[model samples]
Target: MATVLLAVLVAGGVGCALVVCLLWRFHRALDRTPPDVGAFAHSAATRTAGAAAARTSSARMTNLTSALPWAVPLGTSVADSCRTEDRNPFLGPASWAPINCVRSTVFYLAFDGDIRTHLRQLDAVLAEQEWVGSGSSLNTLTGMATWLSQAGGDPSPAASQQGSTEPPGSRPICLSTTYGPATQKRAVPHGGLGLRLQVAVAELPCTPSAETGDLQTDGRPEKSPVEGTVYLTWHPLSTDTVSRSAYTAHRYVAALSLVDGYAVQSTSTTAPPSPLTR
Candidate 1:
């Protein structure tokens, strides 16, 4: 009986030692684990924040573009009004990296009238919107006309002129303006300084070929027989990509630090240090 009792006591002591050993090893493992930067970036909170920012910025830009006054002549029939939207994220002349802070939208409309008259009207409209004219440029009509022809409905005669020195050489005028924040305030969290508006007006002769006409039998309006075309684009003036990138990186690092700290705290508190480990 005494021998059996001694054996049971020995077994109990070994079991307790094994338990303590396991607890010590677990604590050590937790301390040795390193924080994963990638995991923090892919965390739910980070993803949600990114998605929300993109949606908010997109909606704000859409509203601004929708309010613009698109030029269309009265008592003159027109067709195939092509409008294009694009986002400009490049930082500088180098086009090194893309960022989410800068956004640009382009709109095209064709009308029949004097280019100066249309430009004056647009200028007046912009003035009412509190936009200050910054600068203007004059480029050959061929460049602007060719840009309009990409709409794909009909080919314009001006678009056909690649480098031909022809009569009636038209010089398209482009005006750049900066918008004041008196009326249209920038959206919060979008990192916008303000808005810049550009207006490019030119004269182009759009006449579709027989082949192109046959292709447009779907009763869809074709881009043709218009006296002139106008291109309008707007973008935020603030392009501080470095600051935005730094801010984003800081957020990820903070999140990771928080997560790692919490993990360590919870693991440390899981159990007291065993006397055997001590």
Candidate 2:
């Protein structure tokens, strides 16, 4: 009887150790995964809208929109629409004042030219807006350049810097979102596409409000998993560029979307920055 009891205790101890090991590995994986900032901020905004939400005034919206635009190339037609909302989950009651502002603007500009030429134009716009570049900035210029080269163009100047030299044209573009491993390749019209263009111009470095998390856009909302950012999505001219009418008809080539306003945290109390912000 004593021998059986001893054997049971030994087995139980081994089983407990194995269980602990499994739990440790599970926690380690969670640490490796990046936090979903937009989701967290959105949740916070929804929870705090009544008592601690920041508000955007009309004058602030005017000032913000005025400051947002970079010079559009002449002859590239421009159309834009703006909106302000109280309950729009995007216009938040989050910790960051700029994102919490109650308005968003979208600009659609169509350039009647080659995708390469327009890409350069977009590069200039990004530069003027102080968006980062590939080696340091992680924007579309380098990624697209790399993609173009993979699609039979000359090797991209930025290709040497990539960790993987193989073509990423057909790979999923957004790194922030979760998607099931895809079997089918994405269709490419004009050869293939590289990485999606993304750049952010942050405004109002003011004190954070009672809330502790500020969510910024990881890229454009439509193409990227990130939100609360100024995103630029560029569409290449159609393959049938030989027809002038068709080219002209493609009026919406590239789009820029952003949540607009200069709302900042207004609380007098200073709290330690949220760990998420770090």
Candidate 3:
């Protein structure tokens, strides 16, 4: 009876040790597992935000292009060619320039105000000009209004704040127009207008503020102010005919810089080759 009791006690002790060992192993495995929950969540949120921003930017660009319908057909083709060439050697400038080529003109307007408001003002300014368009012809004013209406609402607050200040009214806005005359149109095999114009806007880095004190006196680096640019291009359509002359082929460009809600720098130029006799 004593031997049997000793054996039973030893077996029970061994079983308890095995159970403890298994529990320890399980705990160690859990500890080795990757803790990526927070990282994964952050990555997903960043991707979503990036996609949203891209879409907003694209929409704004499209609206800007649509504002000038007469220039769209030709400008789009040239812009596409440029983008393509930039990506691949499929199309060279020599081959692209002569095709439906026309003398083009680009115009720029820069000011300090809300982007939407500035666009509206630009539309009004263009409407006052007789060379933009007439009855049954492409009207820049109507085109701008239509594009704005289709855009639905105001630009996203985040978009408006890209390196820009708050209070949307204080943001700098730039407008550009590229005009080409029918005289610059390239003859097409088919009977149709072969005209082209292109416009683009880019946000450039701002200039750094000038440091007042010596480097030893001021250990911190000076922060640069935010700045951006708006680019525009114009081209004649491949099919457009050289009928009656309208605007000149000369480029009209303007630039404006604002400081403390005031125009600090303003410059404008209209190139040679005066407008046609109208």
Candidate 4:
């Protein structure tokens, strides 16, 4: 009996050791995942919205790190990449204020072009990269499209016209949201955590229609060429432990705007042009 008891104790001790090792590894993983919001802030400030959005978004991401400890895994490689471009005022000698904001690129998509085609192409390019999420939801795509439509400002009269072939005033742009597999609990609310990526395309009003004499031979108003911005966001979602009944999602850790086109041009070196500029 004593021998059996000793054997049981030994097994229990071994089990405890194993559990401790697992806990250590888990915490280590969490440590690796904290996002470098500083990097995101520096990059975002170079865009059209200016540094305000960057500052706000970076603060939100920092808050999220405190909540969702394992949301964004900034592995050694990613951290190194961020450090290489670390332009944080708190850390660096350079000021946080932007010196010169320049237009990065501009491209025009045909008014009636297949936006989904471009989105799919962009998706392909993203898929080739290491940071992108593996899982995709059609529902998320639908949600993004709706959000873009509302955010793009009031729909033109053409959009209001029923059964219109040209999507009323503007063309349809595609948006996609992709997510990575959750490393912790399931992605479902209650107790889930993971990384999310959102990409959206939208048309910008360039030259006024009247200025460009945008009319077809049939006297129908020709829709303006679609000049749009490609918006990219990285954020995290997590369930609240205190209120297990609900979830808490965080703001974007990184948000970037890129002009879409075969050739990108900077219109000005002194100030960034409006994202809508063609």
Every model's TM-score? 0.28, 0.28, 0.24, 0.23
Residue range 1-278, candidate 1, lDDT tens digits:
99999999999999999988887666555433222322333445434443443343345334433453443311111111111111222221221111112223333333433444444454555445454432232122223334433333433344224332322334322222233323435421222222333343433321111111111334333333312211111221111221133223221000000000010011113221111100
How would you encode candidate 2's per-residue C-alpha lDDT over 100-200 as one tens digit per residue?
22223233333332334444565564555433333333345445544634456333222222232333333211111111102213321111111112222
Which residue pairs come into collision in candidate 4?
33-73, 158-168, 158-169, 159-168, 159-169
Better of 1 and 2 by lDDT: 1
Give the C-alpha lDDT of model 3: 0.28
| lDDT (10s digit) by residue, model 4, range 168-225 | 5453343334343233233322111122333333332212011111213343333323
Which runs in model 1 stand beyond 4 Å of their true positions? 1-100, 135-192, 204-278
Backbone collisions counted per model: 0, 2, 11, 5
Which runs of model 3 end up more than 4 angstroms from their true locations?
1-101, 107-110, 134-278
Q: State the lDDT of candidate 3 residue by residue for 67-170, as single tens digits.
A: 54333122211111000001111322111111110112222222222334444554554444312333332245335434544555444333344333334332
Model 4 lDDT on a 0 to 1 scale: 0.31
**Any runs in candidate 4 off by more than 4 Å, and if so which?**
1-113, 130-136, 139-166, 169-198, 205-278
The 0-to-1 C-alpha lDDT of every candidate, in the order given, reads 0.30, 0.29, 0.28, 0.31
How far residue 29's Cα lies from its native spot in candidate 3, in Å, is: 76
lDDT of 4 at 202: 32
Best by lDDT: 4
Q: Give the local distance difference test score of model 2.
A: 0.29
On the 0 to 100 scale, the lDDT of residue 96 in model 2 is 26
